[model samples]
Target chain A: MKAITLNSFGGPDAFELRDVPRPAPGAGQVLVRVHATSINPLDYQVRRGDYRDHVPLPAITGHDVSGVVEEVGAGVTAFVPGDEVWYTPRIFDGPGSYAEYHVADESIVGKKPASLSHLEAASLTLVGGTAWEALAVRAQLRAGESILIHGGAGGVGHVAIQVAKAIGARVFTTARSEQFEFVRGLGADVVIDYRNEDHVEVVMRETAGEGVDVIFDTIGGDTLSRAPDVLAQLGRVVTIVDTAQPQNLVQAWGKNASYHFVFTRQNRGKLDELGALVERGQLRPHVGATYSLADIPLAHARLESRDSGLRGKIAIAVVPPAHADARQPRA
Target chain B: MKAITLNSFGGPDAFELRDVPRPAPGAGQVLVRVHATSINPLDYQVRRGDYRDHVPLPAITGHDVSGVVEEVGAGVTAFVPGDEVWYTPRIFDGPGSYAEYHVADESIVGKKPASLSHLEAASLTLVGGTAWEALAVRAQLRAGESILIHGGAGGVGHVAIQVAKAIGARVFTTARSEQFEFVRGLGADVVIDYRNEDHVEVVMRETAGEGVDVIFDTIGGDTLSRAPDVLAQLGRVVTIVDTAQPQNLVQAWGKNASYHFVFTRQNRGKLDELGALVERGQLRPHVGATYSLADIPLAHARLESRDSGLRGKIAIAVVPPAHADARQPRA
Candidate 1:
């Protein structure tokens, strides 16, 4: 089987494409023939040795997978051969989804949404679960409340907007002027051009100074520290980005604010919820770029670049589908 | 009317004993002839200019009040003259409760518990509301869960222990070895001497490495930053103490932890809930020291000192009760 292995953590060029032995399913596990996987912030972070202690040398590291079950291990009752599945691999566990074939425990995998293609399902799996957990499970964002999603055109932020809207919440998103139309089309009731406008002032003014009920922070720097300025009484701030610098949060005391720091763990429950939304047409993943399995290093470079003009996830086709769906990205 | 006024932010001696004009009740208000007031951490924080921007100079800055209504203004039907009452003054909105008379909206006042004296009731008001808000409202601490309350012998922590016990939670408190029996009597199931023991190690050992479900942090410095080390997977950390410096919270991301920063606001609902607990003998306030109206400077000095041997609140007798109850502090 062909796989991308990281012998050392440094830059995009560190990922080497080579032939590796295919893994067999253990008990309660299913062997999957990988069709697609996608790039997330965690990918770049891991490739740059941000989590060096967790991933050892010569690791096949990837997170999201949209694949078909090729074989089932002994005691695996949930899945059989040829069933399409989508899931985020258990973080920091054994091998991941960067190879031609992947094996996972049956409990963590979910039936892929019928409406999405392999690339689309792969793009949504990791980011979809993160956005769902941050908004629904942690923040408990309710109906009729207003939510502010920072960097609303990015992978997690884009899905967060849809999830918040699906929960009947009014969405306020921040994006560059060029991406405003893209986010606004995804059910954002109010869109602030972050580079050209002050988001706090715009949100406060738009909501009559009451501020938003919740803030979903996908952008790392200073967002956690400044969340209190635009939060309503008892408002919640959920951040998926782990910041390196310390943050001063004295102002949050006055608002009785809650901050949820999320590094989402893999589970079938959240994936099922996201799939329900996808099936109902309330959610969709926008794949901004596509790459072949060997071109993962190129995808990493594009996603990591500051001026890449990327609006959504970068999908990697491990084994391309026979035909492309309307929602699939153009390679 | 005699009152202790903070003309400037500084040490204890900055307070001036002066005769000021007594406040009158306006529409929807009650004029309270203050029998007692108590010192809260907020008092010292306000005096030290930690919140100088919110508090103006020459302000009367006490928070807890236990007294009798001297008059009621138009549309105020909650109380009549001579009715005993207890409440925390609406924070930063008007003159506080340090003076001979205090005026407050009728909606924020509650009937004093018949079992307590003026000093005892005054000692509990501010701290009780704060503890209730942190545990019951913010953390939503449930029955059969575990909690770690830091500084369990201090003002807010003392009441928090009783509240957690009342909510059927197993309480783990940190205190001096000498105060172990004190916190135990207040229903703490486990007590850790924070001075000598590594709280993280003790908590991990006791809970079998599944840390406490909730942590109530009254002693703040680095507690917020280190909370993740001893928290369960989705545990909550609620802090009342505001740190001046920034905190490194990178470790909190993997735990899916929630941090609630609380500066409690005044409300009658919380007071009523506390009143019910007091009526049922499930809660009691411990008055560690007492001072007369003219001795506020000394009281502040004692409360702020590290070696004062303080156990609970310092009650100020603005107008001492005619007879002392067993729960009342001895002057």
Candidate 2:
């Protein structure tokens, strides 16, 4: 089985394609013949040695997976061989889904949405789960509330806009003017040109100075630190990115706001919920770009470049499933 | 009317007794003859100019009030003259309750507990509201869950321990060795001598290394930043103290923990809930010391000293009520 293995952490070029032995399913686990995997910020972080102490050298680390079950281990009754599935590979665990075959606890794998191709499924898994957990679970965003999502054109932000809108919330997002149409198409009610406009001023004005009930900060830095400024009393701020700079929480204290630092967890239940949304035509994957199994390094490089044109998640085709035969190279 | 005012931001001696004009109640408000007022950390901060920009100089800065309504303004029907009430005065909105006569919106005052003296009610109001909002509203601690309260013998922490226990949660608290018995008497399931023990290790060992479901951090500083160490996955941390130091949230992200910065909101409903708790004998005020209205400067000095001998909140008797005649001078 061919896999992207990391002998040492450095840059994108450090990912080496090597023939590795296929992983086998253990008790209550399923062996997945991975058809596709996707690039997330976490992947780049792991590849850059951010989690070096937790992740040993000579490790395969890609988190998103869309695959067909190749085998089921003892006590795994929910899924069997040939069943299509999608999931976020367990974090800081043994091996990830960068390989041709990967094994995961059956409880953490969900049936792939029948409406989506493997590439789309892989592209949506991690980002969808992140948005769901941040808004629905952590923030507990409610209907008729207002939400501001930073980085509206990025992987997690785009999905967050859709999720917040699906819950009957008024969605506000920040994006470059060039991506305004793209983000607005994904259900954002208002789009602030982050590069040219002041997000805090716009959010406060649009909310009539009361501020939004929730802020999903996909873009860190000053965005997260100033979230409370555009947050209603008792509002929540959810962020996935980590930075060294300290945020002034004096404002948060005045509003009695809740801050949730989320690193998405892997679970079949969340994936199933996302699949339902996809099947219901309420959520759709935006695969910005796709790469062959051998081109994972190139995908990482492009993702790391912060190119303005890459508007959504990057995907990596591991097995080139039949559904992707006519799929375009870019979203 | 007589009042203690801050003409400057400095030591406890900065407070000066002044003959100030009594304020009349406005619409939907009540004029109260304040009988008792309690010292909170916020009062000290205001005196020290920590919030100089928010609180103007020459301001009356007491936040907790227990008094008899002297008059009700037009359109105010909640309480008339002679009604006993308690409240946490609106923060950063106007002059507080450190004077003999104070005015507050009727919506933010609640009936004083029938069973407690004015001194006791005053001591409990601010601390009770802080504890209630942290555990009940922010943490949403449920029955059978576990919680840890730091500074267990302090004003908010002592009340928090009782509140968590009243909610049927397993309560753990950290305090000095001298205050261990004191906090235990308040229903703390386990009391760690923070000075002699590593709280994280003790808490982890006691919970079988899974950690508590909620941590009510009354003692700020590293306690808040390191709360994730003793927090279970999906746990909540509630804090009232504000700091500029950066916290390493990498661990919190992995645990999916929620951090709430609570500056207790002033509302009559929360005070009513707490009054019920006091009347039911589930929560009690731990007033460590009391001073005459003219001795407010001394009260501030003692509170600022952080003396281990001061076991609970400091109280200032503004205009002693008839019911407070038999009350002790200290806990």
Model 1: residues >4 Å from true position, as ranges?
Answer: A323-331, B16-19, B323-331
lDDT of 1 at B114: 89
Q: Where does the lowest 10-residue lDDT sum fall in candidate 1 chain A? A: A322-331
TM-score for every candidate vs. truth? 0.94, 0.93
Q: In candidate 2, what are the lDDT values of residues A215-244, reduced to their tens digit?
A: 998888888778878999999999888844
Q: Give interface RMSD (Å), model 1.
A: 1.1
Model 2, span B98-181: residue lDDT tens: 899999999889999877778888998888988898999889999999999988899888888888888999999999999988
Q: How close is candidate 2 at the interface, in terms of C-alpha RMSD after superposing the true interface residues?
A: 1.9
**Cα deviation in Å at residue A154, candidate 2?**
1.6
* Candidate 1 structure quality by residue, lDDT tens digits, B1-331: 9999999999988898899988889999999999999998789889989889989898999999999999999999889999999999988878888899999999999999988889999999999999999999999999999999999999999999999999999999999998888889999999998889999999999999999999999998867777989999989999998755688888778788899999878799999999999999999998888888888888888888843367778999888655433444633
Q: Each prediction's DockQ?
A: 0.74, 0.58
The C-alpha stretches of model 2 lying farther than 4 A from their native spots are: A321-330, B321-330
**Which 10 consecutive positions of candidate 2 chain B have the poorest summed lDDT?**
B321-330
Chain A vs. true chain A, TM-score per candidate? Answer: 0.97, 0.97
In candidate 2, residue A326 scores what lDDT?
47
lDDT of 1: 0.90
Clashes of each: 0, 0
